[model samples]
Target: MENYMMSGEGEKNSSDVVYLCDEVFDFSTVSSAFFILIFILSVTGNVLLLFVLAIYEDLKNITNLFILNLACSDLVFTVTLPFWAAYYLHHWIFGDFTCKFMTAAYFVGLYSSVILLTAMTVDRFITVVLHNWWSSPVRRRRYAMAACAAAWVISIAASVSDAIKVEVETSWNNLSTCEAPSDGPDIKLGYYLQVSLLFFLPFVIIVFCYSAILKTVLQATNRKRYRTVVVVLCIVAAFFICWGPYNVLLFVMSMYDPRGCNEIERLYIAHSICRILAFFHCCMNPVLYLLSQKLRTHLLQLLHCKCVRIKCKERGTATTVIQNVAFIAQNSAVTLDPHSK
Candidate 1:
């Protein structure tokens, strides 16, 4: 959890003395633990969701389809967590190839997740507000697929820009750090552009879509309007609550020059906390999606179906006996009727 600041050249400043407080904060320990927890829960939950979606034909709706892809992207990102955790723990042991790959995978997943969430919000908005102009299932499927593909393409391009500029340097303290080379202005420019495009733009889109959807729901005459409002509100609240601080911290760090800051150690501590909170976003969606009433009901029905099949196998003899008894009772009643005679 030690914070090491690099010069714009991507090299550790030899003249810069390591502060006493540097020994206290270990980002490796904190970030490693946080990523480990996120990796486990997000991978497990999203995988289970993917399995559920794949096995059940009826669950193949457009929303669920986008959700399935979202889970896949999350899972892919989560899979790279061990490398990061190792980096935090062993101080970037895997070398430059992995360094680039890890960073690329991370951004790719991050961007893809944002895009998917925005798409899901837009899909909901259309279904709720434009009921008359509904598109066919085929068109919806195509659009969802296209959105997913576009997210990946854009993410890859952003990641490559970072990868090309990023360098791994062993600091004076002998810790290996991966960061952008100092001489390149493109790196800083690229970083800022990424923040704007991947995070800020998508955030605005999500907020706008949800707002419109909320307004429409509020104006509806249906008794279920209140319930719909609550659902959309929960989504909006969660999105902001989990992501807002992280984005703020990123902006703060981007603006903060270690040379200018009076208390670098304090700022680093705050930044680390915000980063950990941001990681919470990875697993939050699965909780929201799985805990939703609609999704829960469907999951229950899926479980119930499995239970019924199991019971039928174990109690086949009892089932046969009950069927035979009913058949006999019906024949006996018909024989006694005068019309039957």
Candidate 2:
């Protein structure tokens, strides 16, 4: 049986196992709108975060570096959202090159974000749990830089591996689509790899690191234990909630054989919903820092500086206008007093 690929929430055609589903709902328009909204939010939030970090935070700090890289990763995913939105609204209008490139870029962003998040968790684990394992700031800085570079490289490699399988071709619906080949094995393999690396692996690592950190905090009699635990739980829960369903649904759908129209349609609907939820994750990181005192302080300082500059410019303009008016009045008086002269 032919098997299709699902990338960026768009489906490819699989002819041999075709099942005509009853039109319970038309999700294309809604999906397109959601994608557009997500794109806007992700871009705005991530860009603002990046700007704040660049201007007010030290890049040498591992945490700040990870935050910067994560924002970039979100941006990379977001920049491709419009294209996918267009694909949902219409057929795949763009040709082969964009098809491959966008797919790869999207995957790169996804994988990079997961990697960076995991890296950040590990860094925190080292700082708290290990407590003195790596005492040198310079060494930590070098390692952090290397980690970021390696994350990008690995993400790119994974993305390219699957991206090479994508192509622009006619779907079973007779519309052009960007999709993987009609090979069941390839589709299954890709889904398995994605579920393993993207979801399961990172999720496990993050949980383990956070659990250790929480234990450390508990034993230390720290006053901030409750707050730390809550924050840790929220971080882990948010990641799982956003992406867990999407990956699970994808894995199930890859292995499932829908026997009826209703079953097929239900899967499609669920997949669409879960995929949108996953897309919402691009903006979630910014929310985690919404209550950060340092970030708020930096943002306020930046705004104050901007306001001060504007006021100075206005004062300078007012002074110049006043001087010009005085000069004009004096010149007019001199001209009018010609008889006296």
Candidate 3:
């Protein structure tokens, strides 16, 4: 969950005074509980979204494919939440290998999700801005597949820098924490990389795409197109709003030299809360699906079908029980009146 070194130890000032603020705003248990909640919601929501897309929506559509990948990226990110929850409550007991893997996988999920969102924006821009640009459906599908693959590759590569340097270290409190080494130049590299790739680049691309999309939609009288654009804009807006503060704080922390205990403690609290907010973004996408008429319809139809199937199953069970009871009654009657027959 944390790609940078945490202030888990004391720091010395000019007068030989050591400042340790580990006891300040102690909310480890609460944070862990919230993480568990996020895990459950994110898993349930993304899984349901994927199911609906697979059953009720066409994968051949590039937008749906991007959506499917985005959900998968969210799942990949969310699966790490339980481990993070445990780490928050206690320490890293999973060992070095898992620490590396989970950290890498987490970043991979984060990076790919951002990239996929950017790609989705571009796809929308193309569809709306360049409507007349035609190509074979097969070629377009291939291009979409390539974009998905590239996003994963780039994410994995970016994650390696953080994962390889990660190790389990015993902090000043005698608790083992998983974190990147603070000794090397790589200490600051992760923060800068994240700020650029995860936030800055994606923000620029999304802003440009949506601006073009809005201009085109406004000039035309197409309500459907305008509505779809608005929904996507909302999604993009939510993503940035949740992650923007976290990235900004991270960048500041990378360059920050805390002058006192209060400063350090305040930054720690802010960072932890911002991270939780950032993680919550994974769950937001599925909720945002409610804004999309197509996805909403798919979800409703899926629920309706499940309800209908359950009712049919119950009715069939009741009818079989009734038939069995009637057959037994007739047999009893025949046995009791054998001579009458």
Candidate 4:
């Protein structure tokens, strides 16, 4: 799609970019299916995760705090997805405030998740790889919270500026859009910051952590060490699988566009596909994190209680059903080691 003009300005430029690219492919079919599926999975997974955390575990632990923060970040992205889905089919009609808020929230989700995941890896590094120097419990929790706060502040500051600059654009046939216009320096800076903070630095930390963990676990006698390595690897893999290609592709595009129109078209199409793939990371968090053995035990107990309740109902034992529900709720409580990473 071609476009141009300031908000409510006079005639727009006959040719304009949609989504910072030369052309906007009609990706409604591709977008609609993926967005809806992601929305459902992300919502269900994150919500279940939040519920499990609130009911079964205390958030006072530093590790749980990071997990909670990550889930909230995923939820931030998930909540705004419907609007984006609508925007894909019909351009952004949600007005300026919503355009800014939703777009910024999307960045918050992306940036914050990367940051938190990085933070989690760092914590694990200290706790596992350098256990001898691990600090006091109180100090560890305080420092973890401080790290989380720093990440939030940085991610928001980096992302919110460009998001706020987003204004509605009227494209062909008067369809409105929420793209931020490209200013060469600003876009280059945004892309640089995004690739650096949101992907590169975090990726390095995660890899270092797992590498260190691998060396230690291989030497250690702890049975749980291998399990920790496996889970951490799954997480690191998920992060890269979802965000890696998109980050690399965008960074390259930002650096230089030697390609002609056809190449631009193909690159943007790949970008669109990467975006759809990246969004699925939000949903994967629950499966990867909350499905830990301890949480799984609680889930199985919950299911067992439901079965008992059903049998009690068949037996016409109203009191037993109530008792079963109470029993299940009590069983949900789990004590997680705060520094277990």
lDDT of each: 0.69, 0.78, 0.83, 0.74
Pick by lDDT: which candidate is best? 3
Rank by TM-score, highest first: 3, 2, 4, 1
Candidate closest to the true structure, highest TM-score: 3
Q: Cα deviation of 230 in candidate 1 (Å)?
A: 5.9
TM-score for every candidate vs. truth?
Answer: 0.79, 0.82, 0.85, 0.80
lDDT tens digits, residue span 210-230, model 3? 999888988897567467677
Candidate 2: regions farther than 4 A off: 1-17, 171-174, 223-236, 308-341
Model 4 poorest 10 in a row by lDDT: 1-10
Residue 43 miss distance in model 3 (angstroms): 0.5
Candidate 2, residue 27: the lDDT equals 79
How much is 87 displaced in model 3, in angstroms?
Answer: 0.6
Ranking by lDDT: 3, 2, 4, 1
lDDT of 4 at 282: 89
Q: Which 10 residues in a row give candidate 3 its minimum summed lDDT? A: 6-15
Instruction: Give the winner by TM-score: 2 or 4.
Output: 2
lDDT of 3 at 330: 92
What's the true lDDT of residue 213 in model 3?
A: 89
